[model samples]
Target: MEEVLKKFKPRVVSTGIKELDEMMGSGLLDDSTLLVIYDASSFGWTIGVQVFRRMIELGGFGVITSYSFPISLLEKYALTMQYDFLRDGAEGNLAIVDVIGSIYNLNVNLPFVYYPGSIDSETFLAKMEAVYRRIMKERADSRKPVGISVTVDALPDLFGEDVAMRILRRNLLMKELALMREERERPINILLLNRERASRRFIEWLSQYAEHIVEFRSTSISGVERMIARKSLLPSFTPSEAEFRFEHGNIEIRPL
Candidate 1:
C-alpha cells in the first residue's frame, strides 16, 4: 500500500475486499452508514479492523473506536492483520478513541489514543469530533477520512438506551438525513454490532437508519463463515451472500 489514495469517485470508497466491493455495486457509497451485525463468538469484529486498515491503505484517514473493546485488545489481536495502529497514529494516518478505557478506567498507554476523561456522553462525542475536526483541517491534503465503531451494541450499556439513542439520533440518524439533503462527502461510517448483546427492538431501530446491513454467521461443522447482505441502499447492489474463510490474514470470499 502506498501513502496516497488511488483514483476513486468522490462519493464511493472500497471495502478493501475485491469480491465484497464488487457485491456492493463497485464500492461503498460515501453517504451510507454500514451496520455489520455479527453472530456471537464469530470472527466478524476482525472484519471491521480489516476494513479500517484498508481505508488507510487507500490514502484515507480512519478512527477506530469501541465501547466494549479496548485499544490493548485490538492491538493484540490485530498483530497478524498487518496493521500497526501506534505507528500509523504517529504518522498522522489514523487514530483510536478508547471508550472502554476512558469510562471504565482501564490502562491503555497509546500515544495518539484519545479518552473522554469524563462519563458524559456529550463529552465523549466532543472528543470524537475533535479528532474529526483536526483531520478536516487538512484541507490542502487529499486523504479521505472514515469512522469505525467495533462495538456499537455496548453504547447503551454506558449511558442507557435513551441517552445513547439521543446521541445517535443527533449524530448518526441525523447524519443519515443530512446525507439525503446534500451530497457532500462526509466521513464514511462502519459500525459493528453483536446481535446477541443488543435487544431486537434496538437492533431493528438502528437497522432502519443504516444504508447497508451485513450479517455474519459461522458454522460449527466447518471453518467457513457466511457474510450475508440483509439490507443495502446501493442502487446496483445485487449479490446477496459471501462465503469466506480466514486464510493467513486474508478473507477469501466466494460471492453467492
Candidate 2:
C-alpha cells in the first residue's frame, strides 16, 4: 500500500481584535465557517465587518450574507474601517450576495449578500446552499483557497426557537459535507447578541456544532457604569472582566 500525505491549508488570522481573537487562539481558521449572534447592541455586526476587512487585507476574498441591515450600511462600515476594495485593487477579491429581494443579488466584486423581509427555514437554507456552492466553485476555478464568514444578524427572529434548531442542524450537515469533500474545512463562529439566562439550552445546542464558543454579557459595575465582559472559551481564565465602551463608531475595551 502507498502512503499519501495530506496537504495542509493555511489558517485564517483575525484582524487584531485582541480579546475576541485570543478566545479563538489567534482567530478564525481559513476555509472555516462561524456564526455570530448579537443583540441590536452587542456590536456583533461591527466585529463581523472588522473580520471581513482583515480577510481582504490578507489577500483573501470574502462574502457577507446579511439577514438584516442594508447593503449600504455594510459598505459604509467597510469604508470606515479603511477597506478600499477599489483603490487597493481588491475589488475582484471581494464579493457580496444580497438577498434583499426574492432572488438573491450576488455582488462578487463587493462581497456582500442582502436578504429582504423575513426568511423562512426552507428559503434560507436554499439560498445558503446556493452561496456555498458558488464559493466552492469560485475557489476551484481560481485554484486558490478562500475563507468565508457568515453573519446572521438575528437568529431567534429569523427562525424562532424550533425552526432555528432545525436550521442549525442543517448547518451541521453542511459542515459534514464540506469536511467529506476534502477540498476545504469548515470552521464557524456564532455570535449571540443578547445575554439571557433562558437561552442556555439554545446555546448548548449550538455548542455541539461549534468548535469554539463565546458569550458576551453586559454588566453594570458600581462606579464603572455599564461594561461588557466575556466568558472565555478556556475555563481556567475565570471570565476576565473588562470595561467596554463604544465611541467614535468603534468598540474599545479597557481593563477593569
Candidate 3:
C-alpha cells in the first residue's frame, strides 16, 4: 500500500470556484471532457461561462461555442457578470467558434473568432483547429485552449440526430486521439446539454465520451436548482448534490 501510494500524486487545474473545486476532487482534471447536463429552464449555462472565464484568466485560450445563440448574446452574457470580455478577446485569451454563424455563412467581424465558409464536420473541425493553431502560434506561452459549448442539445434539433451524433463522435475521436498521442495537452471541454431537447440515446452517447459529468436539475421554486457530480474519473470524487441560485450576477451554491 505504501508503494502504491507513493506513485499516486494527484493534481488539478482550478475552476475558480473553491467549493466546486472540492466537489470535483480538488479541481478539474487535465484533458478532461466534462459534460454539464442541465434542464432547459435552469441557469445551467452560467456554470459553463464561469469555467470559460477562468480558463482565459489562467492564460489558456478560451473558446466559446454556442449552438443555441450567437456572438451578440455571448457579449450580453459577459455583461451579466461585468467580465472583461473585450480585453480578453483583444489579448487573444478568448475566442469564439460560432457554429450557428458558420452554418449560416455569416461574415466574421472579430479577429479572435473563427467560422468556416462551408458547413460540415470536416470544415467545422478544421476551423476549430485553425483557431487553436493560430492562438498557440501567436501566444507561445499560452496553455492549450479550453472550450465550452452551450446547448449541445440544439445541435441535434438543428441537424437531424444522426448527423449531430456523427459530428459529436468525430469531435470526441479527434480530442481523444490528440490526448492519447500527447501531441499537445488536451483541453477541458465543458459541454452544456439540455436533456429535454436531446434524445435519450444521444445523452447516453455523450456520457460515454466525457471523463466527468455534472448534472443539474431545477426545482419547482424559481431561481433555485441543484447540481451534482454525477460521474468522474477522479478517485477522490464522491456523489453529492448542492443547491444553488443564480441571482444578481452571483452564483450562490449552498452546502448540504
Name the candidate that leads on TM-score.
3
TM-score of 1: 0.84
Greater-lDDT candidate between 2 and 3: 3
User: How would you encode candidate 3's per-residue C-alpha lDDT over 175-234 as one tens digit per residue?
Assistant: 656544545555778898888888899999999878778888888888898888788778
Residue 249, model 3: lDDT of 83
Off by over 4 Å in 1: 1-10, 107-109, 121-127, 134-142, 173-185
lDDT scores in order: 0.73, 0.49, 0.76
lDDT of 2 by residue, 86-174 (tens): 44333355544455433344333343333332446777777666765676465323433333333432455556777877886887677
Model 1, global lDDT: 0.73
lDDT of 2: 0.49
Against the true structure, candidate 2 reaches a TM-score of 0.65
TM-score for each predicted model, relative to the true structure? 0.84, 0.65, 0.87
Better of 2 and 3 by TM-score: 3
If ranked by lDDT, best first, what sequence of candidates would result? 3, 1, 2
Give me the displacement of residue 29 in model 1, in angstroms: 0.9
lDDT of 1 at 127: 68
